[model samples]
Target: MSNEHFSLQAEIAELENILRTIPEEKAISRLSFESRLEEARSRLAELGEPVVKEKLQLTFRGQPVDGTSGILADFGGKAVEVFSSAVSTVMASINGDIGERGPVAKKDADKLMITGTAVGSFGFELEVAGNSNPLFEEDDVTAGGVVEIIQDLLETAATGTDDEITEVVDVIHPRALKKVSEFLGFLESQKASCGISFKGKSFKFSNNSQLSNAALKLKDQNVKERPVEFEGKFVGFLPHSRMFEFSIRETGEIIKGKIGSKKIDIEQLSDNFLKAPVGVTLNSVSVGEGKPKYTLTSASDIRAKAGGGSQPPLTQE
Candidate 1:
């Protein structure tokens, strides 16, 4: 989507938040925000995108909360961290941060606004600042998509069977799944239950200890990692994605993986290593069922062997 659309969507969401949360007694402030919201909605309509009306609610109960009145400050802060991190990781995964290289930069992405508070339980109502006109399609990386996954994750944690949990996690990005584990850890520690309400549906898990066991089951026991040294022909590398391709000398098969090291000059890799013979040290991580993922740790120009031996190492972990 265009930057204009993105900015306008964010503005609309912010104005709606102000209008929703501002007290009725502050009529002047509410009026101004309402006017702005209307203008934003008009422009969005002119652009052919409809304004989004749905909002997601997160409610907390048990030890950390006191009905709809209040909550412990520290506990609340930790919840925010866990929730935000979970959302951010899922968003990143959706935006193509699948490899182990690193997390995608989320600074430009829309922020979740605290539009209002929920009754009957101490919680907050949330909406993404620019998500009303999501840039991505459904079940993808858009704000709506992220929230849906979060809802599924929470619901699974609460009532899903072990096999169901495994099935649900099979499609989730591992980094995002790690965040899910962290959230379960928080819930387990506080002995609290969380409820996610969206699209007129709600899911909550009250048994904290059971949720903790779910977290353990979420970890993939079949996954393993080992360090190895090998010779390969550097095929290509994309610095932006931190993805690389190498042709194994022993097998002539090409493999792709993320390049995570910072010490190596990425520019040099592109300029000198393309299709060149190189000896590389890497961490091979395997998930048992799929091809192993290689993380380059160090590399040396094997082409230099013609002169005498390998050149000075090109990278150091």
Candidate 2:
């Protein structure tokens, strides 16, 4: 593993050198080089080495940035908020991609590191850090993957059909959906345009007033009425899908839903709670017909009544 790690690192260094030599006007050559570079870095990261997985050039264009000194102070503060919010959006989506739901923890939502500036526009290059930790071995979605989703969602919002936009938004973490909505709202409010570029692909947001519709759609999705708790037996859980099954104690009914807690220990849950009496709190969303969609918010073991008094109930959120 050590040898392979170093070898991958060396390969990545060489690829970066070749990529730097490639002219941006040579689109095909630059793309090929960048592809190879990203592949090498991904491999290195998978070996537990920290790698710069995604590089984005964020360029802001508007009267706020039209000056010889730099960006306006008032706009700069809002711009900082916009940049941080974008990173948080990516972090929340990463959690969702890895089958973890709910808001991202501060420790888990590391910001993209700034790395130099763009030439013409007042902008900076944001570098996303990556590593293949053991915890992420199963459903690892690197920073690059998250960036691709952002690009796709933005592209869809700008041009795709309503159904297409909804489809993409549905997959995003609910928290991220809200953040990106705010991100777009900030852009619209300032009447400023911005561009995000990764490798050969670039997306620009200008007079896209239709983004208001997308923002409304996102806000609507985040509206949850209230949480309802149920007493049941923990039947099963699928880690990759973040889905769980429960058998209700009251009516002998079976319910399945998405799990929203990252603190759950799969092994402990299987050993201690499976087929055991438990309490589940869920947030339900109505879908028009049939059963509503459920998201499990918190759960607790309630097996103490059946000779399990020695151990305190394990609860997680």
Question: Quick one: best TM-score, which candidate?
Answer: 2
Q: Kindly list the per-residue Cα lDDT of model 1 for residues 133-199, writing each as its tens digit.
A: 5454443456656777778866765566654554455445567777877887787789887888887
TM-score of 2: 0.54
Candidate 2 lDDT, 1-317, residue by residue in tens: 35687788788889888878888899987887788888887777667643345577777776677733467768766765676666666655656542236545543424666777765678767776455434343455555566667778777777666556655654555567667767777766776666778767987665446555544445545333346777777688887777888788899888887766666655555666677666666776531121456666544523433632334334454
- In candidate 1, stretches whose alpha carbon ends up further than 4 angstroms from where it belongs are 1-53, 107-110, 129-140, 220-317
Cα error of candidate 1 at position 54, Å: 3.1
**Measured by TM-score, how close is model 1 to the native structure?**
0.53
The local distance difference test score of model 1 is: 0.68
Give Cα-based local distance difference scores for all models. 0.68, 0.63
Q: Pull out the clashing pairs in model 2.
A: none
